[model samples]
Target: MTQNIKKLGYFLLFTFVTLILYLTYLVMVQGEQLARHPQNQRIAAQEAGIIRGTIYDRTGTIIAETNWRGKQGERVYLKQDQLTPFSHITGYVSQRYGAFGLEASYSKELLGLTEADYLENLLDRILNRTPRGNDLVLTLDTVLQRTALNALGGRRGAVVAMNPKTGEILALASSPTFDANEIDRPEVWKQLNQDKLNAPLLNRATQGAYPPGSVMKIVTGAAILSQQILKPQDKIQCPGYTVIDGQRIKDNRSHNSVDFNKAIALSCNTYFALEGSKLSWDQFEDNFKKFGLSATPDIGVPVRSGTLAKGERRNLSQLAESSFGQGDTLISPLHMALACSAIANNGIIMKPYIVKEIRKPNGKPISVTEDSLWLTATDPEVAKQIAQGMVAAAKWGTATAASIKGLEVAGKTGTAETQGNSLPHAWFVGYAPAENPKIVVAVIVEKSGSGGIIAAPIAREIFSMALAR
Candidate 1:
């Protein structure tokens, strides 16, 4: 009996020791995973108790913030109640849905829990107090945003303006916008939820993808320039249409013969079709990808990854259609702005950035964001040639509608045809001060025909406002 008792005691001790070791391993190795588990409502509730930091524009304008209230003997930090019209940028913290936009993207830093935040917290603890959370300063300009909105005039479209040198998004405006104030309200939510034609919640500037139309000629020009398949002086004959594999491709413009520059300036489909056919599908796909046509901009916004279609050589007709911004080619306005950034920055494309800096509540600088290169167009000479073509387009080509009176504007216009009875989408992408650019703008008008008439003028107005500012 004494031996059995001693054996039982030893077994209990060993089991207890093993359990403790397993628990310690779980805490050390899988703590973060457990905290992020959906069942951990307590951790989420604690996060909700703390006041999230504010988001400001470059001019110190409060784009998004939380307002604390001591109402009915209860302390509440209301997010949607304080920030309206800017919800798309700030996003909302909902009880039902997880955080989004800047809120979700920068949660660690905003909540004072990042590595930098940990150091600051430790320092503050040693000093016998808590450090404040950091604030995000954006590169947006309120004036430009307002002007862009006004220019849209309730049209179904989007406008994106950025500093070419810095890749700082100055203004982003999407029409048919919603009021963030009504997000938590049942009635307003019902209305917004039901509406189909006017998707007030969609961020068209980054998420909306459309056929690029003739504006795609810019990429074709780049491909031709890079492959050395053709020279700027090389001419192609056009009878308003070209046939490849018994398929007819039409040019909107009726130019008999056009050189590379003239073809781009007039947006001649035949010229690009012939040049695009000379290169293999892989070559075409590679060049398009280089221009960001087949990629997504890492701007923290929900961006669509535009696609370039692939198929057999007999699909050359389909590929030719894509050369002029038709068929299976699609792109977002934000990506188009980046493309223009490449041209404006002399073939060096900078990554698009929104946040400029972060700071503590006491006004101490905590973090600052610097400009970074995203991609370089294959050849600088090609970008230069494209810039010259864009200059001519603004001066005497289809993009003349975008010409600013005093500022040297270089631009390209695109009118993409869609299936069924829908009107074509209008597109305009450009950079200003032709020789030395300061800003790049991309505008898209859904179901609005004639890029020269609709999209170009709006881009010109935005450019003019930016210059004046």
Candidate 2:
């Protein structure tokens, strides 16, 4: 009996140690996640009394604010006309549904938890004064955002516009969107969740991943050029099709023979398939990763990382197809925008950001975002060479619709084929005033006909409006 008791004591001690270690691990590794979880009642209770901050656009246009109802704060999204346009960016804060988007990502600042003055917080706590959160100044331009949504014309799509040199997101518009104010209704929420086809709650601009189509030729051409596999003036014969490992990939039409720049301008599938097929797996994958695929943009909100097929499973055929942006590769609108921004900014991709400043309730600045380098996609010379090809594309090729009169526009268009019976997704990525780019835009129209027809025109309007500012 004594021996049995000793064994039980040993087991109890071991179990106790394991439990302690598990708890420690949770605290060390997942403490923040647990605290910020939507279902965390403790967090909800703590935030219930705090008056959240107001949100404003780059032009000081009010986006959202809070209304106090006797210690219970209610979030009221303003700008009635822009309710749906800014919904995905501002998100909603609810006692029942919790918070999301900028609201959840910067909740601490919105709850006044990260105030610069600890003594003021102490005094407020001692006096039991009502807590107010900091105000957020975002980089979004209201006019540009509205223009982007209007250009979509209620189509299911997304547009991301940003400053190439600074990475300040000027507009992020995702269509088939929802009004955050209505999400509080159980019936409305149920309907939104049930509509899986549109997925109104999903922020397509940053979250939706789609095949990039010929727009990916940008990366392919850059990769081949960087590796000395092809030169800008190198000529390749395009007989309307090219075979890779017994599979024939067809181009839009036969170009007979064209140089690298002309091939990009015309989006010659044959040229890219032949040239890209020469790249080794290491070179192909490295260029894609370097251009910001398989990684999420650090923009203080949820963003889906671009994806690529497993390297080990890759073959010559798959590589050829992926060279022009097909196969298992996928990229988000924001990711594509950053890639084009790299070329416009002298080969440097700046870190993308939305929030420009954080201000106290009294209008004093607390924090500000500064532009920083995220990646060097290629040498300046290589980027310049690629930019020239895109200029030609915009001038008279597939991306002509995106060109503005008297403005040197540089861009590439893509018509990404979809699965099943769905139509192809239209894509256009580019920047304005090629000599001195001011804004870079990425537009994707889901299940649309062609990038030049369906997407490039929209980018033109966005660029026109942004430059007009």
Candidate 3:
């Protein structure tokens, strides 16, 4: 009995020591995360008591700021309707609802909690002066964001545009957007959340995952080149229909005998189905990973990752379907745009970032977002070949609707089938001035008919406006 009692005592001692060590580690290593967590109301409440810093666009236009005149320390959005294009991103700063979006993402800096501001913050508090937070300069251009929003008017979809070389997001617009001010009204917030049909509060560009459809042929084409099974000039025969494992698959129309370039431009379902057969599903998956499709993108905010079918390809039928972006392959519009951006950027995918810099109220810089390479999508030569294929697509194929005068564009389109009797999702991804690419845009309209018809025109208008500037 004494021995057993001693053993119990030793176990208790061991557990107690482990608990102390864990608490110490958490306090030292994970302190910042805990302090800034959205659910941690203490720090958030304290920040609410203070005057939060202003937020601006890259051009120094005020986007968000706090009003001190109100007794309740009301956080006010400037030019409310004019800035609703930024609604989902600025989020609301309410004592009742706390902070969100960039407000939540940069909470610590907004609260003047950085090491550089520690002494100054302490001094300001001691003096009983207003504790001001740091300001944020974002990469979004109000003009571009407004253009994108205007282009998507009345459509239930999203648009994402970024610089290919720098990964600086220029515009991210989601239709059915709710004004941040709406959150101040509990009844309004409740209605927006409960409206399942429109989902005004949802940030569709980063969070909504959908079938990629034939726009995924760009990846399929890359997989073929990666395996060295097909050259740019190699011939592929498409008879409009092909049999894969006794399951008959059909294309939009017969593309006949065409080379690699024609297959991509025509989006030949049969050709990719055959090309996809050359690779095991593992090889196909490997190529998708090369384009960063299998990874969750670190685009300075929370985002949903693309998904393949739950399991490995069980049969050639599934593999062939996936090649044409059928079956269970799903991707966010941002993911598709970034992948296409890789082709525009000579095979290198730059890490996407929005918050360009955080600055002190005195105009001193606190932090600047750095540009870095995220992935190497393919060999330079292979990427160039695929880029040319996209050009052909814009010139003579389905994506002709996206071609802009006086500027060469490389593009691909997709019309993904979905459940119910509704129309398919329309998608378009492209980059312009092919020689010296400036902007890459991805667009999707849920339950819209054809990507070339519905989505491409919106992309065309954006390109015209962007290049004109």
Candidate 4:
């Protein structure tokens, strides 16, 4: 009986110790993910009565802050310039509506819940002190963001601009934006939630996915050059259209046999569709996967992954369609911008980041961001050839509207045709000063025919503004 008791005691002690260790592991490993999770209801309660941190633009413009003196969180959206343009960036936080965007991504940091600040606050708890949240200093440039939004002119699309070298997002503007101030009201919430046509609540910049159209030709071009399947100057004949997998693929215009540069510049669909057929499905998928079409990039807000297909077994016709950004292929504006930025930055895609710094409540710097490489999709030589083609497109081809006199911009235009009655979506992705690139911009105008006419001009204005800075 004593032996039985001793064995039971030993088992119970072992179980208790194992449970404690497991909990400690969870605290150390899963702690940040748990605290920042959108489903954590405790965040809403804490936000109701806590002094959350301020959010600022790169230029020190206060985008969001809470009034702490009265009732803990009189969450105030300051009437700053270009506030509406940044609505998706500073997403709404409410007890009723839940949370998303930066409000959710950095919730733990903003709530001062990270393990680094834990023990300091434990001492505060002993002294009965009210803890303050940490401030986020974002990388967004207000002037650039406003330029992008205004350039969109209330269209149903988005624009994402970034520093190609550093991956610092200069501007992220989604069209049909709503006033964040109206979020607390029931009527406004219901109206925004139910509106089907515009869907003003959708953050089109990072979350909305559309057929990439000719802009996807950039990826196709990368694959061709990287795999050594085609030379930069390889000649191909385009008699308006060509048969691919029994489907007659048509180009925008008839062009006699031309080299790779002219094909890319003119966005000859026949050339790309034919080139795409030469690649096996594995080669095709591998190229785009390297370019991040298969996954969501790590950005400050929520981003949906752009998809190439729904299944593993892809038909030849599907490959042709996917080659030109049609069929089942869809991509987010930010994703395309990053891809273009990769080309601009010598094939090294830097990881995109918005928040540049984190500061304590008293304005002392906690940490500063260090830019890192996200992917090396191709050789610099291959990327340079693609860049040259983009420059040709800007100078003498479909992207002439995007050309800025004396600035030497390199760009690509895309008009992705949609099904049924929906018109083609206009797309323009580019970088400035081909020799020494600075800002890379991606502009998409929904159901807008002709990327050169509508989207390129929009991008031109943004590039003009960014360069002026």
The candidate that wins on lDDT is 2
User: What RMSD, rounded to one decimal, does every model reach?
Assistant: 5.2, 1.6, 2.3, 3.3
**Model 3 residue-pair collision total:** 0
Better of 2 and 3 by lDDT: 2
Sort all candidates by lDDT, best to worst: 2, 4, 3, 1
Which runs of model 4 end up more than 4 angstroms from their true locations?
1-31, 78-83, 119-129
User: How much lDDT does each candidate structure score?
Assistant: 0.79, 0.89, 0.85, 0.86
The residue ranges of model 1 lying beyond 4 angstroms of the native Cα positions read 1-44, 71-85, 119-132, 311-314
* Superposed Cα deviation of residue 265, candidate 3 (Å): 1.4
lDDT of model 4, residue 18: 100
Considering only N, C-alpha and C atoms within 3 Å, which residue pairs clash in candidate 3? none
- TM-scores of the candidates are 0.86, 0.96, 0.94, 0.91
Residue pairs of candidate 1 with colliding backbone atoms: none
Candidate number achieving the greatest TM-score relative to the actual structure: 2
Looking at model 4, which ten-residue stretch has the lowest summed lDDT? Answer: 74-83
Q: Report backbone clashes per prediction.
A: 0, 0, 0, 0
Q: How are the candidates ranked when ordered by TM-score, highest leading? A: 2, 3, 4, 1
Provide the lowest-lDDT 10-residue window in model 3: 74-83
Q: What TM-score number comes out for model 3? A: 0.94
